[model samples]
Target: MQLFPKTTTFTLFCAFLTLIHAYDVVREYSGVSFFDEWDFFGSWDNLTLGDVYWLDKSDAFSQGLAYVNSVGNAIIKVDNMHSVQSPQKRNSVRITTKDSYAVGSLWIFDLVHIPYGCSVWPAVWSLGGSTWPEGGEIDIMEAINLMPSNQMALHTTSGCFHNYTPPNQLGATLVTDCSTAAGCTVGELQPNSYGSGFAAMGGGVFATQFDVAGIFTWFWSRPNIPSSVTQSNSTSGIDISQWGPPSASYLAAGQCNITEFFTPQQLILDITLCGNWAGLPEVYFPSCGNRGPTGICYNDNVVGDGSNYNDAYFEIPYVRAYTTGGVAPTPTATPFEIVSKVDISTYPGYGSVTIPLSAVTATNTKLQPSQMFFPGNGASQRISWLQIGVGWWMTSIGVIILIELL
Candidate 1:
C-alpha cells in the first residue's frame, strides 16, 4: 500500500537535492553575439560628467568603437584615431545589459585587456535602482589613471556597514561603510590585478557571486584560472564550492540586508574620460603625475590627438551569468534621466556627487534558491536541511496514505 518503495524514495530525494545545488547557466553573452545582449547608452554625459560622448549601436560599429576582433573577442574602445578640440567630448562607448540579475547568481567576466591610462576611467560594474545607491551599486572591477590594482566596492543606503570580513579574503579593506558617495571598498592586494600589469599577464577572469549571505568577488590571472571556471560551459553547471577563497568578500550576516538594499542589477561597462573620480586634480595629479601646463584632466589628457587612449580599450572574451535553478523576474528596460544639479562638495577630495540619476520604479521581487549558499563547504551543507525537510514531508504523506488504505 506504500506510495513509493524505499529505494525509489531515496533516489527521488537525491534528484531533488541535485537540482537545488546545481548552478545552471542563465545567460551567456559572448563571441559575435555579445552586442546583442546589451543596450548602448546614447545620451550625453550626465552622471559622471565624463568628457566623452557615448555612442549608439550603429555609430559604435560604424566608427569601430565597438566590434568583435579576429580572435572572437569583443572590443569596446575609446576613439584613438580622432582628435578633439576643446569644449567637445571624446568618443567612447557605454553599454548596459538588457537583462538584470538579482541575488543567488554568479557573474563571470573573461577578459584579454582592460582600459587604462592617464585620465582614462574604466569600470565593469552593476547598478540596481534608477536612483543612485538606493537600490545599490556593485563595483566589481574599477580603477582610474593607470592604477596598479583593481578596487571592489559596494554602494548602498545608510546603516549598512561591513561588520565581518571573510577570513580567506585576499583584499585590503579601504572603507567600511556601505554608504552612497564613498561606498565600502576593498582593494585587491594581488599584483597585476589591473591596468598594464593585468594586460601583460594575458588578462584573466573576474567572477562575482551574489548570494543571500553576502557578495564575493574572485580574480584569477590567465595562467592561474581554476579549472572549475575555465572548464565550465553552458551545459556543465559550475559549483562554487570547488573554487577557493575569494579576493574580496562582503558579508551580509549582521550588517546589510541583501534583499532590501540590493535589487536586480544591470551590468554596465564603460570608459569615461576624467569625470568625477579621475578628473579631480587631487586624484589625477598624484597617481598620473603633475598635470603640466594644461593643469586640468581634460586639457592635459583628454584633448589633442587621441593617441593617449590607444591603451584605453576593453578586450573581453565573454561574460557569463549563472543561477541555481531560480526563476528571476522579467526585467523591464527603463531609461533613466540624469539630474542637472551637481553637488561637488560631498566627497571632499574625490570630487564626486551623490544621486545624479532620478529614481526609476523599484520592485521587491524575490528569486528562488535564496539561501546563503557560498564558499561551498559549510554553506552548501547548511542548505541541505531544507532538502531533508522536504524529503521527510513526502515520506510522511506516503505513510498517511498507506495507513488510510489499511
Candidate 2:
C-alpha cells in the first residue's frame, strides 16, 4: 500500500517537470494561410541583382506575378518573357512574415519547389530587428547560379562565431567568424541538397531550431520526412523529440551567447538575379564559361537573353513556429484519474494512452493527461498499478486488485 502511494507521488512530480520542458506550437501557416501571414516587401532595392523589377504589394498581385495558386499554395515567381527581353531588368518577388520570432523558437518549412536558374539568387532567411549585422541574420536556404547544394549562413556582430562541433559532417563550414563583412557560412555537401537537384527530387522540408544552446538546422528529402510532419494537419500534436539528430548543430557550449547576438527576427523569402553573389563577374563568368561569347554577358546572355525561368519559383506547403516554455492556451479539462498498469520488464513499454476522463463540469477536452514514461528517462520508472475513479483512495485499491487478476 505504501509502495503504491509513493509511486503515485513520484510520477506526478516527473510529469510536472516534463510538461515544463516541452515545446508547444503557438502559430502555424500553411497553404492559403501563408499568404495572410506574410506581407510583400517592396520598399528596398537590390543593387546586387542590378536595376531590376520588384513587385510591390499591389503590383505583385495585380500583375499576376505573385499569389496563392488554385490549390492554396503560396507562389513567388519571376517573369521569364519580360526578364529575357529587358536584359537590364528582371521582375521578382520578396515577402516577409508579418510577425517576428523570438529567441528559443523552432521554425519548420515544407517546400515543394525552390527557385533555380543561371542568373538567379533565391533565399529564405531571417533578419533581426536591429540594423543589418547588429541584430543578426540566419540564412536558411541560399543558392546562386546552378549551385548543387544550399548554403546556410549567419551574419552577426563581430563577436559571434561557429564554435560547436557539428553533430555530423554534412556541410562544410566555409567561415567561422560571423561578421557582416564575410559572415559565417556552411555549404551543404549533399548533391541533391539544393538547386535543380532539389527540385528534381520534388523539394523537401527544412527546420530551424533556435535556442540558447545554439542554432540548429535539419533537412529531410521529400520521401524521408517523419510521418508526424507529413500527416500533421495542425502544428499541435507534432513532437520534435521523435526527430533524430539534426544535420547541422551549432551549440558552442558557453562560448557564444545566442540571446545577446540574435534579436526578434522576421522571416523572408525572395528571388533575385545576376547581382551580388551570383552576378559577381568571378562567380557568374566561371559558371557560364561554356556559354562562350554569347553566353556569359550579364544583360544579353544571363537575363536579357531570357534564360528559362520556368523553374524560378517557390511552392511552399507550410511554415510554422513552435516555442519551448511559451504561454500555453488555457486548458479546459480538470484533473481526473485514468490509470493503467505499467510494464516492469527491463525492456520498458508502459502501455499508456491519452483518453479523456468524462465529467459534466469539464469544459476542456484533455483531462489530467500525462505520459506513463518518457523513453530514455530511465528504466526504473516503468512499473506502476492501475487507478481510475472519482477519488484515488475510494477506488484505486479495488482497481489495482482487479487489474492484477486480469
Candidate 3:
C-alpha cells in the first residue's frame, strides 16, 4: 500500500514541479513567439534572464513586425516594420551557440505557417555555428514559385542534402552519402496525392527535434499532431556530428548553436521574391521602394528611404516551444502509427499489401520492399476497421499491435 501511495505521492510532487517548470521550459521552446508578441529589442541582456527573448532593431516598429535596412549586402540596421504579406514571408534569427543551449538539454520547434505562392520563399531552417560543413544546417520548409514544392534538407560536411518531394513521388535518390568529408541528398513525395492543398487547409505544423543520439528527425501534419499520431510520418534522423564544425556558415558555431551567444532562436517570416535564390534578375531602381521583380514595371520617385527591402513574406498565427522547467505540458511520449493500409476490398492479401508509398528514403535505406507490410485482414466485420494499420516493434524483432484506421 505504501509503495503504491509512495509512488503516487512522489509522482504528484513531480507533477507539481513540472507545472511550475512547465512555463519556464515552454519559454525556451517558444523563444520566437515571445519575440514576436513582445518588444524585446535592445533588451538582449534582459531576455537572457528568463529565456524569453526579442531582437532590437535600432529603428522604428511597423505593422507589429520588424524591418531592417541594408547596412549593405549582409549587414543591416533592423527596424520593427514587418512589411510583406505573402511570398516567402518571415524573418529569422538564431539562438544556439558553441558554449551552451537555452535549456541546456533538448528543444522542440513547432512551426505553423499560412500558405505558399510564386514570389514566395518561405522557410524554417537552421545553420550550425562551429564550422561550415561541420556545425550543420537544417532546411525545414523551403518552397518558391519556381519550385512550388515542399522540401526538407540537412546541410553538413558530414552529410549531403536530404530532401522530401512534395507528395506522391517515391524512391530516395543519392549518388553518394554524406560523411565527415562528404555528403548526400535524398527526396520523395507524400503518400496522399495532395499537392500542398492540405497546407491551405491551415494549421500545418512541421516539427524538428535535435537530440544527443546522432539522430535528428523531422515531422509534419496539417494540424498540430497529438504526440506520436503516426510513426510513418516521422523523418529518419540524419547524423551530422561527424562533420566536426561548420565555421563557414552564416552564423559562427559559437553564435549558431550556443544559447549563451544568442537568445532562443529567432523566428523569421519573410516571402522574398527573386533575390539570390530564385534568380530574380537585377532591377534599375530609380530610388528606394521602387524596385519590383523582373520585366520592366513603371518606377516613380518614392518618398521615404523606408521601403528599401521590398520582398514577399508570409503570415503566422502562433509559435510556442517546449523545454525543461517550462509552463507548457511536459511533452508526452507521442506514439507513432506507421499505417500501411491495403484496400483488400479491391485486392485480397496474405502477401505484401501495396499501399500508396511516397515518403522520402535514402541510399542506405532501400525503397524496395524496405519491409513487407501485412495488414492481415483489412475488412473484418467483427474486427471492425480498427486493427488495420502497421504497428510498432523493436528494430531487432517483428511488429506488434494492430490499430483500426477508420
Clashing residue pair totals per candidate (backbone < 3 A): 0, 4, 81
Cα lDDT tens digits for candidate 2, 1-406: 3434555655654544344334656577776666776667563333233334667768888877787888877788877655355435667787777667766577888888898867677888887752455567788887776676677877777688775555453456666777644467666655566776688788899888777677777677787688867876654645565565565556645555788888767788888776556655666665654554655535534444454678888988778876654222211222222122111221111111101112112222111222212111245123212211222443354455444433
Cα lDDT of model 1 by residue, 1-406, tens digit: 5566766766665554444445667678888898997888875567777899889989999999999999989999999999899888999998888777767788999989999988888889888755666678888998888567787888888888775776677776767888856588777767777888899999999988877778888888898798888888756687565466777788877888888889878788988988877877777776665644666889887788889789999999899987653322211223123222222222232213322333223222111112233213465556545545655775565555445444
Per-candidate TM-score against the hidden true structure: 0.78, 0.73, 0.41
Positional deviation of 204 in candidate 1, in angstroms? Answer: 0.5
Question: Judged by TM-score, which candidate is best?
Answer: 1
Query: What is the C-alpha lDDT profile of model 3 across 167-269, one tens digit per residue?
Result: 2212133313233221222221332111244345443444444322122333444543433322222222212112121111112222123222222232233
Clashing residue pairs, candidate 1? none
**Sort order, lDDT high to low:** 1, 2, 3
Clashing pairs in 2: 48-275, 84-306, 87-304, 332-364
Error of 3 at 235 (Å): 26
Give the lowest summed-lDDT range of ten residues in model 1: 362-371
lDDT of every model, 2 decimals: 0.74, 0.61, 0.28
What local lDDT score does residue 31 receive in model 3, on the 0 to 100 scale? 25
Error of 2 at 286 (Å): 2.2
Error of 1 at 21 (Å): 4.9
